[model samples]
Target: MMDVWKRLLARWAGGSLGGGWGVVLAAGVGVFVPGPEAAAQIVNVQALFDEATAPMGFSGTADLSLDWRTGSTNLIATRLLASAQLRTPPHTVLVVARGEYNFARDELLVSRFLEHVRYRYRLLPWLAVEAFAQHELDAFRRLRARALVGAGPRFTLFSQEEASLVFGVALMGEYEQLRRDGEVDAGQERLDPRLSSYMLGRVKLAQNMSLVETLYVQPRLTSVRDLRILNETLLVVTPNARFTFSMGFIAAYDAEPPATVSRLDTQLRTSLGVKF
Candidate 1:
């Protein structure tokens, strides 16, 4: 894993790449972490992987959200996200990190952090291979830690100037450890081999406007009923080459969640991004 990141950085430093996509700003979205009394926790990152303006060389974006209220019920919530990508021809590497905190009534309600790294190498015009690693911690779900690594081939099902579709599948090993809460074996540690599959689609509605949709499914190799699914849809509009506005919806479901947590969670977000 370290070797992969090392190679990507080496390649990025080897050449002088040009062009730029200005800084992107995502605003007006407050992250709400589910507490023990709330629904399940699912963090979908598909919308974070920007497909528009895939400038050659290097690009990055940062997002921040803050909400505060001082009334009968005090509340404060904040979220931060940072992402960087390096594209060198057939090789591309992307990294993302996000953190969230929510507090209400002088008590901490939720805290979460997530990190992901992905690398893709194109072998042909229609085929490519990808590998990714992810680590996460969520206090809302009583999850102390979760990690996974996977690699597999991706195919370009269809491609056009205005529309495209892609799909991929991989086998991944997942490890999870829950916080000790004495509720339904909350403090147990488990590992499972699972199949991860996804489909991504993009379509241009008009000049400077587009829609992107992504769906992910993961099921244990031995127990198909133990499944996880996530779906995200985003509508993006770019008035010019420097700014972007987007609204997205995410829905996630876990077949076997914590006894105290619900099976489904959903989120809606709207943000404007500026690029330099």
Candidate 2:
């Protein structure tokens, strides 16, 4: 498929020297949108503890998503920390509308349109496949989409300690044709403000007992540019299925200045949640 695309581009445009085809292939695994499924309908909420210890600051996330899929289409509303979101996926066809609600100052942040659609097909008991494409959105206040595709598989591992471990690996590629409306000069083309490809994998040791490690790495035009290794553990207790408490810590490195937006320092966070 790669070769075919290359040849087609070469033949057209009078023997051009551009590998825009390669660029498209590079941005195929990082594009996706939220969906409303029966299994995911119930509000799922999570909270992370935040901390700071020299050269680092740690924090976790807290959010819940509501599912709406029936009749002629699908929709999802997710509320996290200081933000709320509304999404609409066109009746089985794949056009999505997204709006963000800001609570800190109480106002509408933005809204936009999205394209690209995909469905999943189970290949085996432990394997599944999903195909998607680059989604288009309207955002005059920020960077727009270029290209992205992310796909992978997940595995379930059980240990004698009654620990259920779930892990998955995915390859993501995205092209960021970022438009410089602010900050730097216009049409400056944020050099390498994109990651050609990225690797993502996570291991969940126990749901409420603790034990989780994740690896994330992506390049940018500014900020530190290197892979990051983070170690996190959570002590969680649930009074019931509807209410819970959690506290945790995180350590990160190889990701600071010139490659990211925040300082590369260890951090910590804590939070409480309730779902109905």
Candidate 3:
């Protein structure tokens, strides 16, 4: 069992994700929308969602960042994220949405949007089941849209107030549409089945600080060479019950991407979060 686990981990590491995909996406989307314009739109949408919602066993956090600079070079960058979780008895639900836009010298450098929703039901102390759906769009990558839906089992490795670890495996179906670009075929689309697996861990680092790490792997059922991996690490500092400062690093890799796109994308973000 130990050797089997080691082999699995080695295989995962061998397919580690890369980070140049974002640069490619940014370059591709630069011509369609100006950076400042896109940033404004994201900010407006975030503001609209900031209004309070009636309680329904729901609690969440929201973050917004905006910056503008004026000089020989003018720059604007904005990001907004909102996530909510609902817990009722043995059932739990989570939803997240985020967008980012960046502009430098009046040109759009990056524009992307992502959303995910998940539902889980605890069937036993150590076992649960979950279903999830996700959507993504990145103008820079010339990804018109991608959608995924899946259901799977989640197993608890450890559970405690200050620390926890979990692993999940799911069978998913994905549909993707690609925009016509010089490099990618115009109106490209694919529908495929994939196997998805993930490990998640949370630990308390200090009295008011905590850490979370998650690693996800997805490989096309019909093509093992077509794989994707995502890893995210977050550090959160809570000064009080109502507010938090969080920094996160994300890395994503694709074994086979669109002709024009790179295989890896990476992002780092820091934001102030308010809890309701």
Q: Give a tens-digit lDDT track for model 3, residues 1-276.
A: 434323322332223212223222322222111000010011111111211122447788888765442321235658888888787747766677888788866677766777666666779888987666555666766767665555777888887768878887777655566677776476676666677777777788998997878777777788888878777787878898788887777666777777655576555657787888
* Model 2 worst lDDT run, 10 consecutive residues: 36-45
Which candidate should be chosen as best, given TM-score against the real structure?
1
TM-scores, all models, native as reference: 0.77, 0.41, 0.73
lDDT of candidate 1 at residue 201, scale 0 to 100:
88
Q: Kindly list the per-residue Cα lDDT of model 1 for residues 188-274, writing each as its tens digit.
A: 766666777788888999999999998888777889888888787888888998777777776777888876766776666565676
lDDT of each: 0.63, 0.32, 0.60
Task: Pick the winner on lDDT between candidates 2 and 3.
Answer: 3
- lDDT of residue 225 for candidate 3: 84
lDDT of 2 by residue, 1-276 (tens): 434432333332121324233322332332331111010010011112111000122112233322221211122223233211112221111212233332223444442323333333345544444433333322332334333344555343332343334333444333333344654433322222222221222233455444434333343324334343334455555556556565545443334222112333343435465533
* lDDT score, candidate 2: 0.32
Q: Model 1: which residue pairs collide?
A: 22-275, 22-276, 23-274, 23-275, 23-276, 25-273, 25-274
**Which stretch of 10 consecutive residues in model 3 shows the poorest summed lDDT?**
33-42
lDDT of 1 at 7: 35
- TM-score winner between candidates 1 and 3: 1
Off by over 4 Å in 2: 1-122, 129-148, 159-161, 177-209, 217-231, 252-265
